[model samples]
Each structure stands twice: as C-alpha cells, then as structure tokens.
Target chain A: MADSTKKKITVLMVGNPNVGKSALFNRMTGANAMVSNYPGTTVDFTSGTLIEGRQEYEIIDVPGTYSLEPRDAAEEVAVRMIRDHPDAVVMIVFDATKIDRGLYIALEVMEQGMLCIVAVNMMDTAHDKKISVDTADLQKVLGVPVVATTATSGEGIRELAEQIRKAQVADLDKIIKRLNGEIPDKKSVGGCGGCGGC
Target chain B: MQKKLLELEFGERGVVREIRTSVHDLNCMGIRVDRELKMVTKQPIKGPVVVLLGEMQIAIGLDLAAQIIVDVIGKDA
Candidate 1:
C-alpha cells in the first residue's frame, strides 16, 4: 500500500545531545522514539514517515552531536548520517534555553550547503525558566524557516511540519551580514521577503 | 583539591581541571577544562553519573567520569 510514483523527501533531525530532538521527531512522525531527559539517550538514528501538504517525507532522527567533527561513536553516526544524505533537508533542533550551544552545530550543518530548517524545541521548559527565544529573529539570522515548538505538549508541531517545504540552504556570508546589521531588513524592502515565495 | 570527577559526592561542585582521555568526547558534552560542574546524582553499581553543566544536566558514564579531574569548589547546602 505504498505510493511508488511519489518521491519521498528525506529530512534529518540534527542537534546537540538532549535538545528534545527525539521528542520532536516523535511528535512530527507519530513514531515512538525513545525519549528521556538525559543526554545520549539516542545513540543511533530512527526513521519514520510523515505526510504533509500531500507530500510524503522520510524523517530520520539522527544521533545528537555538539559539532560536525566526530568526537565519539554517537557523534560519528551523526556525521555519517549527514554525509550519507547530502541532499536531505536538515531539521536542526535547539533547546530553547540553550540556543547558543545548539547554534554551533547548526552552523556546521549549514556550512555543508544543505537545505535547513530550525526547530526551537522545549519552549515550555524555557518559559518556566524565564527564557525566551525569538524564532523570527533566528529565522532572519539563519535565513531558514524557524519554528518554536514544545514537543511534549504537541505545541507548534503542525506549523513546523508545514514549514518543512519552506526550508532553504542558508548563505553563511548573508547570515554574517545580517548578524552584523550590514544587510537591511528584507521584509521592509518588500521584495520576496525571504518567505520562500509561499 | 583536584580529584576525579567520579569521586565527587552528590551535590558537590567543582571546576574541570583535566581530562585524561576522550577529550573531544567530554568537551562535546560540555565537560571542558575550566567549566564548572556540579554533581547531581550517581547511579549505584557504577552506572552513569549525572552532573550539572551550566543549566543543562549531563549523564556521563563512570569510565569517562574517572578520566576527568575537577578542582573542588565547595558544595550546595
């Protein structure tokens, strides 16, 4: 009962250890990924199918890593997953309270020139801890569709899935320029607005 | 004083001083030199030891913990 005619878009979930990547993956794909509080819970990758906007996606939950440089077996697996699926759309997950640490690996993945989207997961915990991350600002900085999500309560899951099609390969130079305030705000300019024309 | 991370009792706080092995592995987990770490919990029978790194809690196995040396920084009351 599979649709052989339709091509599946591959999406790799990458992030630092224990940023709720597995939790977000479970919410998106309805697949039971081993979820736990501690880091290193997911030392391997799990695959699941997701259908959104009449398109099928094969989502792979990759092992968490702090950077692209392989430091351990789990990190090696994450590095290999990116190498194996060079064309896959990378879904980078970040703990809302620790976005800085997650950004390191996100930059590494973006440097590889893959289409990417960002999920600032654990919003509930961040809210409890009095931490707030501006997803819109992050989107502008990375030039990717960034969505704030709380995987535990199923908040913002639908919007994240819908934004997958809007994923884009970010330009490092552009991101640097935007961060330095060298580039004018795209929305104010009234061009494409970097919305992926959707 | 300097002691292996595994020797830090529960609720003990310390700053990482040296890592004898798997430097990259420990560093990736936020166990780099000069970073403050607090012992959160320890599993019995040599299981993973949980430590607080900044606002994050990381569970490191004993083998890796034994390789990390930390300078004692008092304990939480």
Candidate 2:
C-alpha cells in the first residue's frame, strides 16, 4: 500500500547509435546502475536513478535506433518500449553534427504525445565541423526544452536535469493540430515499397 | 541488360535503373533512380559495397545492394 502511493518518475534516453547515450546514462546515474532486458525481448537495457531534492527519477537507456518504424529487432524493441511507456519522459540524444537525420526520429517521437526533451549531444564535435545550432531557435521550433550537451565532458548535464525536473506531458492535441498534415502515414513514409518486396 | 549493383566490378560504372528495396531508405542516403554511380570498393566475402555517387561515397549492404539494379551501358562513359 505504501509503494502504491509513492510517485516514481521514469525517463527514457533514446537516440541514434553512438550518440553518447550510454555515457550520459552513466554520468547521470553514477554508481546506482542496473541492467534488465526489455519486456518480451532478448535486448537488455540499463536503468538507474537520479535524485533531485525529494524526488527520484528512474532513467532507462533505450536501445539506439534510426527511426521508430521497427526496421529490425532492436528498433522493434525501441518502438515498443516508447509506445508502452506513455507516461515516461522521453529524452532524445541527438548528434549535433547530423541534426537533420536525427530530426527524422524526433518527429516520430513527438507525434506519440509523450513529454519530450531534446539533448543535442556531441556539441564539441559539431564545433570542430564548424556547424552551429541556435538552441533558442530550436526550442521555439520544437515547443519543448532543448539542451545542448557534450556527454563525454559532462557539459550541460546539470541544466538537463533541471529541465527534466520541469518537463511536462506534451500537449498532444495542440501538437497534432499545429503539425497537421506534417506527419506522414506509416505505410507511405519510410515503408518498403520501391519494388513491393518490403 | 539490367544487373545487380552487387555484380558490378570495382571501378565499373553503372546507372541505377530500379531499387527493389525501400526507396525511402535510398532517398535518405541521397540515392535516386537514373543516378550514375561507380563501384569504388567491395569488402571481402559478403560485406558492404562502396560506391561513388557524384562526390559522395556511400556504403550499402550486400543484401540491399543486390536489390539495386543498374544498367552498365559502358565503362565510365
């Protein structure tokens, strides 16, 4: 009965492969880390806890995937996890160098109507490539919190935690209305139909 | 005659005729129908083949490569 009343917040960290998601997970969770297989799959995911003041958050490092379209077993697991956990906070760790490609997944995630945050990882490398992103402009565009981060060096992590604390459930109706006609039908976008062999 | 992209020899050039797999995936990588490409390299056994499309070098898996049919009109014509 006591456990039923306790509020346990869950946060999911998702991104493309090699986007520093595991590194960020380690930094955020420190020594309190545990690994468990995703429900009904062989793929295992890491989970840990982050405590701020009196509140505690459970953070899971979701398997890296290019899109939520379930192209493979890993991607299937990722898409299912996101779909099952509607109340979890979705944090997308994006490679700043390939923001355009990352946005593809971002659009899919936002359409799910979960509370979301964008962590633009690898900012240091983006700087090396002479690519600059205006975070304020990005925040205005996505209508959510956007934090620039370099997970390797622990930059912007504190700000990310603060934002996570403030994260709220996404306004699905408002977002869907604002992005009307933007989201493509699942069968048309990224579906295998070039030669009908799928 | 139409030949699979996997069958092209290194340094051989061909024009993409049809994609048997997901066209959206190819489009994401900047590949398109009628695009000219040159086989740059192919890994040992059944690995990905590297092709030069314009100024960009793309590596595609052998399974997907087989689905990309190209017509070899001539040698680097």
Candidate 3:
C-alpha cells in the first residue's frame, strides 16, 4: 500500500501484444499480472502500486495494442486508458527484438503530447538473436529517457524506475531533425543531460 | 495453393494473401498481406492457433484465423 501523504504519480505501461508488458509491469509493481508468450493474454487493464526512492507510483498495466486505432474491444480499452489518464506518465515498453513494430505505436502515443519513457524489454532474446539496440541513440532521437531492460531477469529495472522523473513530451519535428542530423547531439554539450538526477 | 489460415496443418508454411475481416486488427498483430508465416500449432476444439511471424509467435483465435487467406508455400517434414 502507498502512503497517502506522498504524491502518487500515475504511470501507464503501454506496448504491443506479447512484448512482455505484463512481465515488466509485474516486475515493477510486484503485482501478479499473468505472463504468457501469446498475444491477447491481457485484455483488460490492471493497476498496482510501486514505491521507489520515496516516490510512489500508481502503475497501470494497459492492454497491449499495435496502434491507437481501436479495431477490437481490447484495443478500445487500451485507447480509453490513455485518454482517461491524461496526466499520467506513459511508459512505452518494446521488445528489443522487434523495435520497429513497437516504435509505430510509441510515436502514436507521443504524438498525443504526453510525458513518456521507453523500456526496451527482452534484452536476453535480442542478444540471442544478435540484435542490439543503442539506447543512447534512441534516447537522443526520441528526446526521452530510454532504458534497455530484461524484465524477466530484473536487469536495468532500477534505472528505469529512477528515470521516470525524466520523462519528456517528445517533439515530432525535433525528432525528425535529430534523426536527419540537422540538430547537434545534446549529450555533446550538456550538464547531466537534464536527467534531474544531478 | 491459397487456403484459409485456419485450414493450414501444423508446421505448414504460407504467405498471407488477404484478411477478410478486421484488417486493421490483423495488421496490428503483424498479419499483413505478403508476410510469410508458419503455422506452429493449432489447439483442438477450435481453440486459438499459433503462428510464427518472423521470430515472434502469435496466437490468434479460430474466427480470426479463418478470415486470413494464405498462399500455401510448403509443409515441414
């Protein structure tokens, strides 16, 4: 249970189906979200509490969807969760092996102008497939905190939790500029990268 | 050799030809036309069928599978 005196931040975990969103949610919140390898395993949203570094988060495990366009009842629920929690920080989860597919929806969520962070889950499977995602590059391009994690093994989860405070509303134009090498990398001339952890 | 995805036997391979219904839903699930896929398993009693799309395995309901038309490529021995 979270202490009522502390301000609780709402974090919504969103991702593609079977991208380990539930596993990552269970890891962060210690909630028993049924984990499975198949898609549509979680059709409804589940909420739990997570206390990290004296800050409490009301984390909601949103049903996974490929896009905001609701084609099914489950997808409708996922879209509604984002609309209902307007001020919540969206934690977009992705399978490290299939970043492109997840990025499509991530961009859709970011386009709504919400504070967002990214967790690249399934690092172990990505490594096994010889696929490597540069989190630093992703962070620079999206202008959000991107953390690579293997939720099943509890790797990099702490950093993800700590970096939630650094979530940013991504600028679509700037993202394009950065991707095209039009803007200089911020890390080259920066103080703590404005991670709010200095 | 076009057939409904639901008709594909276990360990059969095919490329998606068309999705009759819920095109957006099936696309989101990575079942787009022209994407090669393999039938991994089909549960008895008209339960969900699992298919391998690239390195990912997706379990789709029988109704959904029945709507997906696939061009049979080969069968795994």
What DockQ does candidate 3 score? 0.31
* TM-score of predicted structure 3, chain A: 0.93
For A1-198, candidate 2 gives per-residue lDDT tens digits of 114345978999887666677777887888433323222222447788887655688888888777777667877778878988889999988878767656767766888878888899889988987889777556644667788998779999888887886554445564465457554433433632211112
lDDT of each: 0.89, 0.75, 0.89
Candidates in order, TM-scores: namely 0.75, 0.67, 0.75
List per-model TM-scores for chain B.
0.95, 0.92, 0.95
Which of the predicted structures, 1 or 2, would earn the higher lDDT when compared with the native? 1
Every model's DockQ, to 2 decimals? Answer: 0.28, 0.22, 0.31
Per-residue lDDT over B8-75 for candidate 3, one digit per residue giving the tens place of the 0 to 100 score = 99899999999899776677666789999999999989889999998778899999898999999999
* CAPRI quality of model 3: acceptable
- Chain B alone, candidate 1, TM-score of 0.95
Clashing pairs in 1: none
Native-contact fraction for each model?
Answer: 0.23, 0.00, 0.23
Rank by DockQ, highest first: 3, 1, 2
What is the RMSD of candidate 3?
4.7
